[model samples]
Target: MTQKTMSSLQRVLTSLSHKEPDRVPFFLLTTMHGAKELGISIEQYFSQARNVVEGQLRMREKYRHDCYYSFFYAPIEVEAWGGEVLFYDDGPPNSGAPIIRNAENIKHLTPPKIEETPCLLKVLEATRLLKNEVGDDAPIIGVAMSPYSLPVMQMGFDNYIELMLDQPDLFAQLMKVNEAFCIAWSNAQLEAGATAICYFDPVSSTTITPREMYLKTGFNVARQTLAQIKGPTATHMASGRCLPIVEDLANTGTAIIGVSVLEDLAELKSACRGKLTVLGNLNGIEMRRWTLEQAESKVKDAIARAGSGGGFILSDNHGEIPWQVSDEILMAISEAVHKWGKYPLTWLEDHG
Candidate 1:
């Protein structure tokens, strides 16, 4: 039988379906890196829809990555909900202050309509442009912070942690509002042209929220939100100690789960095998600091660990690809994946 050659979309979708494509797909959690490559300040890159589209296009063209993710920062929804954001010329935006300081404020809070919010509207606009320009050539993912992180953004992380224990009922109510907002924002992006929603939930890890609390609030809300989305959905768990909740994350029914280098890729692959595509485990910080030889070694190691059978994507473990990562490093990662990541169980036996 003749094997099929897959486009970027087909390759990603194929892997998401827990099957192999011609080669392993590459995903970058890019933000500032794209702006840097475009020779523009991060502020300029995210200031308008056109700049966002151009930056993403240039980055995708340069990397020729299998997936292009449209993400500005984690605080888009928070900014929409009246939180302040500190924009930097050289880096991605950062959340400035908490909008909801106490649990009592939760009752008065309301979800922002995506169309009425400036930053979110820009994101949707960029998604539309990318879809029109790229057509069906590659998969364009629209990103939003998951319910776990949303509450953290609204109230500061420290306050949120306290609420999880002191005011569980209030936290649960806030999560419901955040979940509704995430669903609306994600659906708008999907309607605008994103093929999938990559929901980022870094605060749900055992390191921050207790496993039991997360399962009750974060996990439940994530499952509900994923169910409402029409297209494929991916959950990006950015915390280091994410191993404990791997099964809970998979239970949310996301088509893909973004694993960080902090977790054991082999263990995650074992847990998620034939269930959902696992996309990651590369340390973005280490990748940025390593030489070409070092980077290639790590890339090959990741492939050897998780790039078996099908259902694995080569990617950076963190949320945003750091600006320190040069184009050479990024390209080296792609080259190494193409060279070492091939289907079938023969290579593992040879190396092992």
Candidate 2:
């Protein structure tokens, strides 16, 4: 085999530019795995920027993955709005209570300043450390929850759904506040040297909301929020099906879209062929039980389906590596990508 040539950042950028690079880049999205590497609990690992950065560096060194996940638990963003975060031994953190209770509260809320938020500051610091140490070699991915989706934590999901349907104006008000925070926070990461922001907008998916509802609320809010961010971006709807709105997703000025396992990878690749890079489809929940051979087969299949061109990043459907996934399985997936994801995938053209 030929010696690999591109840095992970260059590899990813080349793919994003819609051309084959040396190989397909992979982002394992190993949030908790980093904590596991340090022999510490996820909660303690997240408490310090140095610990998070050290763990991320170690993970990349061991796995040969392409990205630095300069991210914290999902609810840290909610913490900025005064929500309490309760961490777990097996997964990401969750909110203790909904910060916004009444519809009227939405109208009066002010977006929190970065300096005023402790956990968010730690995340940014971790990003800065990654940039200083390894930004030249790999892409540092930052995440910003979409204004339309932050309500899943700002208030409870059921409450958000009721408000979204019953009081559209109040929903719009909440979006305005979230929009400001999302833009500011995302731009801050870019300023700190993140390659792109992952615009995580799960509730906007067709599985969760109707087409008309998204176009009216989530779509418009995402467009506005994504437009104002300072750097490149990827719009991800977590594990929700995106095929119905694939074109709509492509139109959001994002360079990539994270697709669900529910969508056919080939169809998704065809749908956004020239317009966007495609990332993910492996089922994180099911992956915990995957054998080495099964993991390799999944990688080969994903590459056969979507790796023909230059716009693919191998990853999980939900944008996170579940803690239950064994280290051996993750290593197998990485090794498989390196085996089958080389550019000008002649094997696929011949056999697929």
Candidate 3:
């Protein structure tokens, strides 16, 4: 079918399957910004399942993008595990004090039951709401932090790193707990109607740990968690540090591997050729700062760099697009992708 004739869900699935859809699918990282367009506060945006559905639907209608993700603050899982989380009126909630204060604290921890936690329950509710409203019109992505990232959420980031190096055995035990929670949480989202589960692992990047350390700690846990997820899965690590382990990450069997703006898309496309679908490279920070012309130029550049065949999704390299980026800029990005990211990119090369 032509790009105009295909539904968003169809376009995303086709691209994930390494086939050319009518066009390259556009996937937004956050729906919180959509709240502002709908004339609601960030607090209200995250408070109700219906509000999130409304905000995301508004953005999809306005931008005509191919995918909608149900992402709230990253700390909900942490909060469910008894960690403190600080909320904000205009931004995502922040991780507060570490729950796993020391080695002994791990003994007291228990895997959170999804149904018992209001914070996590809301996300599941939002997924169901979106599925009911959008049906097959668009792909609804469920979001979760990576196993390594989850520990950093419950324990402070610096503390978790220290634990990794200072107390290896203790850290492994903690990872087991995190891994179990990730599996259960991911499965629940899949059952709730998310077409795919996207895991963010900013901590496992080489910037945070060596390849050997990551393989022992983060990589294995991720593989175990992902193996249990019943639907298509994607992973995002927000640094070039992940480059060294690209092949390893792909081997974990996730269908999509996210590429940050810091990494060269050309390199990723080459490395992930047949193994993983590549999603990202647009710098959300730059998108927020650039004018319409500049933003469109960047989108066109990303497509030229990574949109050669299929197995690509246009997206921001980071977790979420900043709330301050104007709707005009967001629309410009969607329009540019549709205009320049058509499949059979050979057509553009020959015509241009």
The number of the candidate with the highest TM-score is: 2
User: Model 1 residue 13 lDDT?
Assistant: 76
Q: Which residue pairs does candidate 1 place in steric collision?
A: none
lDDT digits (tens) for residues 98-150 of candidate 3: 77777778766779998899989999998999899889889888888887787
Maximum-lDDT candidate: 2
Give RMSD (Å) of candidate 2 vs. truth: 1.3
Q: Model 2, 115-203: lDDT tens per residue? A: 77888889889999999999589989999998888899988999999998899788878888889999999999998888899999899
Worst 10-residue stretch by lDDT in candidate 3?
Answer: 343-352
Query: Pairing residues by index, what is the TM-score of model 1?
Result: 0.95
Q: Compute the lDDT of residue 163 as modeled in candidate 3.
A: 84
- Which regions in candidate 2 have their CA more than 4 angstroms from the true location? 1-4
Backbone clash pairs for candidate 2 read: none
Estimate the TM-score for candidate 3: 0.95
Alpha-carbon TM-score of each model against the true structure: 0.95, 0.97, 0.95
lDDT per residue as tens, model 1, 1-352: 3356779888887777777777788886687776776677887778888877887888888777887677778777778998898987656688887899768999878899877788888888888998999999998888878877877778887888888789878877888888888888888889999998998887876766788878777788889999998888888877446677777877988877788777788998988898878888788877768898887888888888888778998888876787778889988887887777656535678788
